[model samples]
Target: MTDDSIYHVDGDLVPASEATVSVDDRGFRYGDAAFETMRAYGGTIFAWGDHLERLERTCEALSLAHGLDASDLRTRIDETLAANDLADASIRLSITRGVQPGKLTPQPEVDPTVVVYANPLPRGGLEGESVWDGPATVETVETRRVPDEALPAAAKTHNYLNGTLARAELEGDADEALMCDREGRLAEGATSNLWFVRDGEVHTPTTDGPVLPGITRRIVLELALEAGVPVREGRYEPADVLAADEAFLTNRTWELRPIATIDGHEIGGGPITARLSRLYDERVEHACYR
Candidate 1:
């Protein structure tokens, strides 16, 4: 997809300039919407099934008006990619609370607003300031990640003002921020899931924690277990991560990325991290969408 790629607004295919939603939509007023960022490769999406399931779950979590099903969203992605004449691109599918007139209530009379667009994303520059395969450093920022008590962090809703500001709180400490909950327990990265390599095993927080249960994080767990590497799901303290062999963050675009530092201390990218990274690559190498 190029800058000129069109957007599939509702059921019509229109140019990016021609697509627009109402300004007074509840999605704008109450931050009521659920969305997902999906990565595509080799004519197939990475974790396509998982992403869809998560999308369905997000809609269920937020109670958004569903006008299109998962199958229809997939077809829209295919059509948008074809219109752009690109084989690989990142797609965004957002279902707002629909364009309703009432500011107090958001029950819409027209169809729910479904927007799908694609953007051309390159292979990226790795972390912030490292060679392609080199490691990145993370630091604990000042802002605390909101616990599930206030707002359900599990739902990928539009209520991201806190997360957005927390990102700014990481200004110069390190390349990125690893957020901790109010109880001072490791939650997750500002935008990704957390994984620590220690004693030849990979440790991550369980679903009971407030983490988003990322699709890539789930993939890493499967990879670890399939490779005969121990994968445990439980609460891992910040101290445990510091004492571990290595640490990494998982997300869709880059999959598993190594972290060389946390909270100002240099971390070692041990053999275990290398083994997991390399083995996972070899296992999913065939899924590359190039």
Candidate 2:
């Protein structure tokens, strides 16, 4: 973000330096909020509908009725991007249960706080370059993902302590951390979804587990199926990934990042990974740059 960057706060566009949420806001006080990380290509937000659906699901999980329509949020995101003069960018949209009496229980009536912000990034398409420097070096962390029964894995909420602690275990030794569930089954990365290829099959941890159902992960699975590639989603162990022929990670920003190594073991991108990457790029081009 630049000095002149703009942010949309509660329907108003404000300078990044001046944008403020009340100290008493529930999102600040108790991590009571929902958000989505998105990417824009050629001035258009890719998978806008998908992101909106997930955001709505997250808010529903928190029982937060924001009382704002999709158009309102979309306009805010568009305005923020235009204000920042960014065509290709990374975007974040947050909706927090607004200020109420200081208590654990939220009020039925709500005055939600909404915020939208963006940072410029390289254009994404068939001709685009990756945001990542290179394939990520990941290490399996001892920190386990919070079980879905404890906290619904589908909700993209403000509480990210699980990922924070998992990443902290890295101690700068690796670019990412792979977290497992309480049963020692592979879940996901601190921020991205994990993927591995073995014997011409693409495999990832099932979303039914503690894994996040990532937007990019969904797209890759669809693309792989549409392209006639075998894909599987099930509980997996670290050893399963370690023995794979190829590996990668997925997120809104990273798109599909090849995994260079896991725990110092060399398991890099392969033909399948490259093919899926190209397909992802083509999807971006068709969606935004066409």
Candidate 3:
């Protein structure tokens, strides 16, 4: 795709290449911003409500001014999608602390910057050929997740250096990186929530701490509950994940991705994951297409 796509920056709609942000913008300077990644199917954003809810919470926690509600966000997204002639796309909405004149402090009256843009979804699904096209291989990198004391994982802020560093360790050999918490307990993947299956039961980390309460992850849990699939959540170690029969990752763009191996150790069969995957796909189909 060319840089010809249209994007919404603040109150103006401009070409992607022409959308300029100030050098002094907090988002550009200190990563003082919040964002949401969404998927659009046939011009309709899937899970828009859930994404907006999380974004509002993030804004509140960061003391960033939020100018748009869900309805406003939907209208702006529709406008961008139409201008770009995009029906199936991956959408990103970013809100920043805005530009502070002379120094680092944000003035109370400064308006927050809002940007919304859409890019063509890859071949099969939103981001690329369905993440399910093949099994993934992951590595447990040395980088650990930022502790809740330092930065709450639930906030979807622009400060993602931790994940960036962890993913860099892959160097293209592994499909993804699984990060552990400060205490050496399995936390999550570089960009997705994690899950593991063992003895026909599903296991994942609790959202009370250390994990981004992903919208997709929430749906998976709901589906598991409905399907009568056994589910467990708590602190788990890498050894527990490595010993599982199967493992998977979930995110807004990629609904589900199965892990075939972790640190080169082959994961066993995926009976539990298979069932949940089917249910998750059906749920998405209904939500996005119906």
Candidate 4:
């Protein structure tokens, strides 16, 4: 980000340094907001329709009806990217249940607060390099994922304390924290989805659990099937990942980052990981750079 970076707040384009929300905003005080982290390649957002669908789902889950249509939000994102003079960038779009009375209960009438910001990133495509230095080092922490029953896992709300505490447990010993479900089944990374390969099969935790259905995760699954790789989604344990031939994590930013080690056990990328990474790059090229 530059000193002159621009941001979209409410419906106005403002300097990032001046973009501020009310102190009494529900999103600030109670984490009452939904947001999406996306990537733009060649000035076009990748998987835009999918991201918009997920954003709508989150808003529906929160019952915070910010009466803006898809085009409205897309225009804001485009304007912000144009204003920043960024083509390949990491974009974050947030919608909050605007300022409300100081109480646990929310009123029926809603005034939503929306913000869009972007930061430059390395170009992404077949010829592009990963944003990460290399494969990530991860550790399984005792902090378990919050059960969907307790808090709807599907909703991408601003309440990230669960992930925050999980990462804090790492204490910088690892690059990412692996969380588990209440039943001790592997969940996901603090902000990414987990995947592993064993006996020529690709396995990941089922999203029916506490795992957030990541956009990259969904695309990778499709790519695997299209490439004729056997895929499985079910409950997994730490030992299962540790014993796998290869391991990796997925998200908008990391893409398909190989896990150099998990719990000090070496489980780096293999042929499958390489193939998947190549396929993901090809997908990006076809979508954004073609």
Candidate 5:
């Protein structure tokens, strides 16, 4: 693709090369930043408020400085979309501890470095159920998810080395890996949330307990509720997943997916996920597709 036209950061429309961060920033030096990936369609961002809320929550949990209030952030993002001439696109925003070179001592009072980059969103429907594979759910597991004590699993911080390590186990067989907490209860995926549909109820792990509270997961819950589906969140064993009638994963990039396997057997996204995925498509398609 041609070089990305200048994207927006903070307030300026700057060239990608000029969108720089100090080498000493904690986010760069120690991966001390937090980020959120969001998608925009039809000139409007999907779940803009929810994504902002989550970002704010992550910053609050880390006690990190939030450079701009939510309104300011939204206006900036809207400006970014206009600058990019976008109808559909993906946005990645990251903020790190400000420029302070080398040295181990952590500093907290400085301004956070914020960078926003926009790119074409994936075409989507690459595998939403009827679009691809035989079934939507697939098996994936590694060492259980990193426990909450090890690192805040709820925050979308730069510290994902544990998730990275877990995904190493997903390389060969599963489309994604189900990470468990140290206690071995279902945590979430290396990149998404795990949902099990059994006897018509939708079960996903609780965010306050474990797993990143994905923006998409929250939206799904609301949509499911509006559609009269019962959704529950709790601690689930991967072993429990094996007994489920259907399983699926949800992420901003993937939306809703049905699982056909967990560790080996044919555990699928079940009828619940299929109905849910269709509902999601019908709802989001209006918001995301012009």
Candidate 6:
């Protein structure tokens, strides 16, 4: 790792290259971990409270009692950012079920591993520049998302083979892949929540299941309501997405990314998507830099 690159493993700060976990770590052996991807601007983590709340809830759901609390994690993030000398960056904080030998279930009292790292985003001297220059091209991949019955979709666990396989299906076809649920309904993208605008209203899949409750998605809904833009959440099919006037995606790393085309068919002019994108950035600026 470079001089600026450092990672916190457990409670110790070390170079990224020196960071290592045991071979028997549950996170490595069985994907027993919870993680959050966050963004920071001007050295302040955007939507940090929301991210921490989600992380705590996810860990609880996964039965992972990682000792680190929100305040502790926040201080670590600050130290890591200062050590890297980065004002704007993407941060990934993960906690695993710790080390266990050849057992399918982890011991209840096992010490969990906590890891945090930061990577500078493409700000390029302008704080308001878009992460991706334009829109993203998406395609419906063959891999379907695991049903909520099989595994809780709301838990941000390390078991991401579903998304990995779905992304693999888009190897050379599109910028990203959209996965369907077991019932053939539009679920979400590989790593983003899917949303579209139709008839002057915003629509997206309900968070009942089969979709990660994205922090950006939550903020977008709040902003839309504050702006008096009609918002609806429920089950939607591929036909509804294809027939929508405009479409976009949301995630913590890249707040809002408009979709240019889906399965080769172009979406509508991104009037609402553009509005929400601006509103999202405004929210970030107000929350993180004010």
Best by lDDT: 4
Q: Which candidate would rank higher by lDDT, 2 or 5? A: 2
Kindly list the per-residue Cα lDDT of model 6 for residues 107-212, writing each as its tens digit.
8886888888999885422257777767888999889999988888888989999989998888564778999988899999999999999999999999896998
1 versus 5: better lDDT goes to: 5
State TM-scores per candidate.
Answer: 0.87, 0.98, 0.93, 0.98, 0.86, 0.95
- lDDT against the true structure, per candidate, is 0.74, 0.94, 0.84, 0.95, 0.74, 0.85
Model 1: residues with Cα > 4 Å off, grouped in runs:
102-105, 108-110, 122-134, 288-290
Candidate 3: give the clashing pairs.
none
Query: Which has the higher lDDT value, candidate number 4 or candidate number 5?
Result: 4
For model 3, what is the C-alpha lDDT against the true structure? Answer: 0.84
Q: Write one digit per residue (lDDT tens) for candidate 1, span 1-290.
A: 55666998887789998888888776777778888888765456667788878877877776665767778888988888788876556788887877676666656343667888887654321111222355667877777888787777778877777667767877564566788778788888877888887777888877677788888787778778887889888876789899987888877765667888887787757777777667655544456622
Identify the runs in model 5 with alpha carbons over 4 angstroms from their true place. 9-11, 15-19, 122-140, 285-290
Candidates ranked by lDDT, best first? 4, 2, 6, 3, 5, 1
Tell me the lDDT of candidate 2.
0.94
**Model 5 residue 150 distance off true place after TM-score fit, in angstroms:** 3.5
Candidate 2 residue-wise lDDT at 281: 97
After best superposition, candidate 5 residue 168: deviation in angstroms?
1.4
| Per-residue accuracy of model 5 over 88-144 as CA lDDT, tens digit each | 677887777767647766566757777777776644432223333454434455577
Tens-digit lDDT track for model 3 on 1-290?
Answer: 44598999987889987999998888989888999999887677888888888998898878887666677778888888888888778899999988888677767665788899998975333222573457788899999989887887889999999989999999566878899888899889989999998888899988766888999899899999999999998999999988898888888777788888888899844777878877876766676666
Q: Can you list the residue pairs that collide in candidate 1?
A: 41-289, 42-289
Q: Give per-candidate clash totals.
A: 2, 0, 0, 0, 11, 0
- TM-score of predicted structure 5: 0.86
TM-score for candidate 4, please give it.
0.98
